[model samples]
Target: MKHKRLFSEIKADLTKVEKELDKLLAVDDPILSKTCVYLLQAGGKRMRPGFTLLSGRFFNYDFKKILPVAMAIELIHMATLVHDDVVDASLTRRGRPTLAAGWGNTVSVATGDFLFAKALEMIGKIDDPGVAKILADVSVEMCQGEIQQIWSAFDVKQNFKQYYYRIRRKTALLIGLSCRLGAMVSDGSLRHMWLLETYGHCLGIAFQIIDDILDIIADPDEMGKPVGGDIRQGIMTLPMIYALQSSGHRERLGQLLALKNKKEAQVQEVIHMIKNSDGIERSRTVVDKYINKALKHLEELPKIPAKKALRELAVFVGERSY
Candidate 1:
């Protein structure tokens, strides 16, 4: 099935989440309100919220209780993106000027801080201390992961173990939390929650891998930013790691990557070298491995439409180009 059609089951719930986001983001200050709304309107897959809603369906799918958690997860995700743009010095996202680009870093930082505070406020309404702690811990770990990335930048010798550690904290934890929170809020069985969380965690890893691959290979127009953004920033990704480990062009690739200030041509050259190597294909194989693991977890869940949807979602994560 096509990606859009896969989410048809939760379309209405996602729409409600969208409306709630607008209501929650509204503020007295016009600038903050507009910037927040702009970020919301920039559009994302809402995959985290979708996972929450779908995971809830396996139990008592209480939209009233589930919506706040979904919104909070999405808000946290958006806030991270805003801060990431500032950290990465990104100019655009989804083909539009990023908050940092349009409003400057000071305003962007404040905007990200505002979103984080608001997300905590929203999730706090849920009367679950465990849930609150989980979110808080995940948030802290994500920040730590970013710092780790900063410290490890341009280090071609970084290993697979370090890469997995960084991505689990950076991308997988919150997505896994999304599924767990959905099951928890709706009072699903412990088995169900664990299964869903594992599925999300595996899928999240694959999702980030694909994103890294796209940064190297996707069309600039489709990607909404320049390709090789990761390489340019000296953030070694899975594909780059593989190329450095096994590619015939490792020497030249490492030399170009090690440059403190790479010209545009040098960055493109690295991209070209990696593409022509086994890195892209090897990275794709790993994505498949995670997707299979995600699907395996789904097999134990109750046989329902949501299970099928989750299966499709996992496949999409492995295959998405942007």
Candidate 2:
């Protein structure tokens, strides 16, 4: 099934969330307003909000309560992207110029901070301290993950455990929280909440792995960023890690990665080497494993349309190319 179709059940709720995001992001300053609007217009899969709304459907299905959470989750995600572009020095995203590209790092950082503060404001309306704490803790962990990535940049010696640790915080935790929050606000049983959170965590891992794979193989136009952007920035992803560990060209790959300022030819050479290695295949295998695990968690949940949607979402995550 096409990815957009997977969220059909929650389409209306997501629409409401999108509208709320527009209102929430409105600011008086013309520059900040334009930047916020541009960020919103850039568009994304809205997966975090989709996960929240889908998980909620299994319980009370209260849109009134769930909408704020969904909007806040998306806002947090947008904030991260804005800040990430600054950190990565990325010029484009989703086939458009990034906030940093247009307004420079200072404005981008401030915009990110503004979005984060707005997210917190939205979360505050929930009246659940547990909810606030969960989001806060995850936000802190995400920052830590970014720091760890920065420290480990161009360091080929990093191990599997470190990679998992960074990704869990960087990507998995928020997704897990999205599922957990949906269940919690909708009065789901503890067991159901656990199941959904675990499902989301596994799917999140698979999602990031596929993203890492796409960074090498996806068409730049489709991917909305340059191919090999991760490697160019000295950030090591699963494919590169796998190649360094087992590929015959590890020595040459390592030397190229170690370079602080790589030419386009060198970046393309590294991409060529990784594509020929087992790294891409190995990463796909890992993604399949996590997708399987995510599916297993859904099996124990009650049979419902939401359950089926979540299952399909897991499959989509494993196979998505862009």
In candidate 2, position 317 carries an lDDT of 83
The parts of candidate 2 lying over 4 Å away from their true place are none
- TM-score attained by model 2: 0.98
Question: Global CA lDDT of candidate 2, please?
Answer: 0.90
What is the alpha-carbon lDDT of model 1 when measured against the actual structure? 0.90
TM-score of each: 0.97, 0.98
lDDT for each residue of candidate 2 in 187-219, tens digit (9 for 90 to 100): 999999999999999999998888889999999
Cα lDDT of model 1 by residue, 1-322, tens digit? 3766887888899889999999889898978989988998898888899999999999989999999899889989999999999998989898999999999999999999999999999878877888888888999999999999999999988899999999999999999989999999999998989999999999989989999999999999978888888998999899999999888889999988877779999998999999999999999999999999999999988888988999988977877843
Model 1 C-alpha RMSD vs. true structure (Å) is 1.3
Record all residue pairs in model 2 with backbone atoms less than 3 Å apart, i.e. clashing: none
